[model samples]
Target: MIRSTRILGLAPRVAAARATALWPQLYHERVVDHYNNPRNVGSFDKNDPGVGTGLVGAPACGDVMKLQIKVDDQTGKIVDACFKTFGCGSAIASSSVATEWVKGKQMEEVLSIKNTEIAKHLSLPPVKLHCSMLAEDAIKAAVKDYEAKRAKLSPSKQRGSGGLINFIGDKAAIV
Candidate 1:
């Protein structure tokens, strides 16, 4: 017959099993598996001539995101989009999904993507809204970069016309 101490010896194993069973229930939430194992989470050094880069952050949420887009200059169509994010799971998922959604999209069409769409795509919680905001800002920043560079090479600018001298700022372009 097992003594009380012997019975206590089995208590730990029983508790562990119970904890394991309850883990899924306790942690029930919608999370993006792919973002948890994010792919293409870095830079492309040798992109095409018409590619642009964007970096945006939210100090309040302590999240930073960088988005890069390769586009057909003449058609304003995005051939590729990629992202890097530093934050929680939701932030990473937001950036990841945003990149996928923006790729193969025309500039005008890409503009239609909103932060709410990214949040919905990731099924983010209300507390993680900053993640979607970062994605949205990054897209706008990338487009602005592409447009600025294109403007610099335009024929009108080649005539030494320096009217307002508008400029687009990317990560490095930031002062």
Candidate 2:
């Protein structure tokens, strides 16, 4: 027998197994998995051109999440994702799942992954719904940040026009 089993004996192990079986009633297995072993839980350099960052706070739940995504500028595919969350298990799991899902996906496609889907996968209760929403918001905010940064660096802004100009406006051309 293992040391734990030998010392504590089989009764506790059996009880733990039973509790594991019952724990899913309050938290889904997936949520438990993500919470116990959170994925991509960290920060990337916010100033990095390839990285996009999102910060969301839920005042009601007092949860704050910072999610970051790294994308291939040419391909628009997410190369990596990371998140840091200060909140409940559902919130942590939501962000963790978001990072896992967004990695390797196109930015546009990542936008389609919804809060409902995250909530469903985690079996979140109604009270915890906001947590999932925050995760979704994080993804959008990050993508928006990336797009805005890219726009600043775009070739259209570099055309020998002096300062920034409205590239799409015909009247403002070559000024």
Candidate 3:
């Protein structure tokens, strides 16, 4: 009986040690490191032909996300991306990941990218899942802005129709 009691106590101690060691991996890091800080956090003059800007938010969680891209209109390629995010660390991380993923990508390529991929890259917790969703929406919004510009330059063409379809293709599709 003494041996059994000693074993039981030792097991809990071992378990606690393991839990402590894994805590950082399991919990969301609350602070945004400089690298993870959302950069380009404000609007530029998107009226310029090559600029694309997107703004989005979730009222339920009180999270707001904005993303922008500068594209080479001739090549249909993204030349740069920037983001500003308001929320927890996870939101910041998601925006950071989204900006990295969108920059230098072809417009078509950015469309294929997924929120789950951003979440996976950041190792986001489930409770922060909405943050990833916001990132994805922001990307799509920026792309729509780019496509809209493309359409405006050649108003007689259907250049942005597919993108317009994509705009309303998801759960949070903004009209």
Candidate 4:
């Protein structure tokens, strides 16, 4: 009976210790911030020539992300970015951070963005790593869509298209 009472007393202490140790591993500050308040969560004008739309999904996790980018034709730089993500905390944070990083970056530079960067920034675990990959793929898809649209225009239209500058209000110019 004495041994049973001692074991019961240790249970509370052990549970408290476990909770304290697991708290940080289960949640990252940045991840929680982004998850609660996602950035650039919207859709741009899909039919606009300056807008490139990318829609991607992960079958295993049933996550879907739609990312859009508006480019400056003359400078070949991203002028604005937006995204709508339907997934877990990691997926939402990945897409949110991707949008923030893509704006003001050139198409080529945006393509070079790696999944590792997103994962590291959000402090994602192994299971959530795939969310970063999906974010990267979504950016590439949007860029490809832009390129494809640009290719279809006539030379005169192509030249004129470069003059359409996107106005992204409230977002600071990174460079």
Model 1 residue 155 CA deviation (Å) reads 3.7
Question: With candidate 1 superimposed using the best TM-score fit, by how many Å does residue 97's alpha carbon deviate from the native?
Answer: 0.3
Tens-digit per-residue lDDT, 1-175, candidate 4: 4345334456767867876676457879888888878999999988888889999999999999999999998899999999999998899999999999999999989999999999999999899999999999999999988876775653323222444233346442222
Per TM-score, what order, best first? 2, 4, 3, 1
Mark the 10 consecutive residues where model 2 has the least summed lDDT. Answer: 157-166
TM-scores of the candidates in the order shown: 0.70, 0.77, 0.70, 0.75
lDDT per residue for candidate 2 within 10-88, as digits (tens), equals 5777878876787667888888899889999999999998999999999887999999999998898999999999998
Report lDDT (Cα) of residue 155, candidate 3: 41
RMSD of each: 8.7, 7.3, 11.0, 10.1
Ranking by lDDT: 2, 4, 3, 1
Q: Across residues 1-175, which tens digit of lDDT does each residue of candidate 1 receive?
A: 8547333456867867876666345332434454546655777552445877889999887888989898976677888788888887777877888788888888878778899987776666678888888888898898877767776665343212432243344322211
Instruction: Output the number of the TM-score-best candidate.
Output: 2
Instruction: At residue 151, give the lDDT of candidate 2.
Output: 63
- Top candidate by lDDT: 2
The C-alpha stretches of model 4 lying farther than 4 A from their native spots are 1-25, 155-175
By TM-score, the better pick of 1 and 2 is: 2
lDDT on C-alpha atoms for all candidate structures? 0.73, 0.88, 0.75, 0.86
Which regions of candidate 1 deviate over 4 angstroms?
Answer: 1-30, 46-49, 157-175
